[model samples]
Target: METILEFISKHIEMFYLIILMIFVGIELIGHVPSVLHTPLMSGANAIHGVVIIGSIIVMGQAHEIISLILGFIAVIMGTLNVVGGFVVTDRMLEMFKKKK
Candidate 1:
């Protein structure tokens, strides 16, 4: 466990870059089947809700004010994306509703 922690501590930035790349790859090439895409995307949107809580967690561990500020910004962006995603999804569903 200590060895793993040491390795991670030594390679924090590389791990971050690799994770970022993986997510980018997922965005670019991880096509979902039509039937599952909307549901998965909505589920993914729910993930953004974690950002604000993450910011608070980060704030507790922050070594500098800048880190706190950046965390706050991330929280704001994540919240906006979560809310906007839901709103757009609702509009899309409404488009398909049969009108009287």
Candidate 2:
């Protein structure tokens, strides 16, 4: 467990990015039915929110200035992707709705 944590701590940025890419690839592969795509994407986007908040916590705990700064940047970028993705997903869903 400790070893896993150490590796994760050392390579957190890569880990976060890999997870994000996996979600994106899943979305791109068209496994989600069109009817469920937006909700699925929105749900998946929440994962980024977790990454952002987690990075914030890590930044607060970090002692090294460089790591702290990088973590802070990660928080901002991750949050934008999460929130903006949800908004975009919602719009995509709305586009499929029948017009009045």
Candidate 3:
């Protein structure tokens, strides 16, 4: 569609930056040691908590149905990510404890 193409053209640089970030993130994460994973996951969960709060604020301010729906989805997904991260971190910590 012309509109889609126009939108893509208008934000081509952003697309390129996103692609670059994806690759960089993959490379960085792939190289992280397993011992550091728990800490990294905790940090990621903290970031997602902030994202969830921000999405809630956005949803509160949204006047359009579409915007509110998208914000709600973002909040749900962010909360899931944070909860999952905490669960995983807890399990990883358990693995380090001595078994009685």
Tell me the whole-model lDDT of each prediction, alpha carbons only: 0.75, 0.79, 0.81
In model 3, state the lDDT of residue 99. 59
* Candidate closer to the true structure by lDDT (higher is better), 2 or 3: 3
lDDT of 2 by residue, 1-100 (tens): 9999999999999999999988987777566567785577686786557777788788788899899888889888888978887787777778668666
C-alpha lDDT of residue 86 in model 2: 78
Model 2: how far is 38 from its true place, Å? 5.7
Predicted structure 2: lDDT: 0.79
lDDT of 3 by residue, 61-90 (tens): 999989988988998987887777778777
Name the regions of candidate 3 deviating beyond 4 angstroms.
Answer: 1-39, 42-48
Q: Local error of candidate 3 at 20, Å? A: 26
Ranking the candidates on lDDT from highest down gives 3, 2, 1
Clash pairs, candidate 2, are: none
What's model 3's overall lDDT?
A: 0.81
TM-score of each: 0.48, 0.53, 0.53
Regions more than 4 Å wrong, model 1:
5-43, 46-49, 60-63
- TM-score, candidate 3, is 0.53
Candidate 2 TM-score, true structure as reference: 0.53
**Candidate 2: stretches off by over 4 Å:** 1-32, 46-48
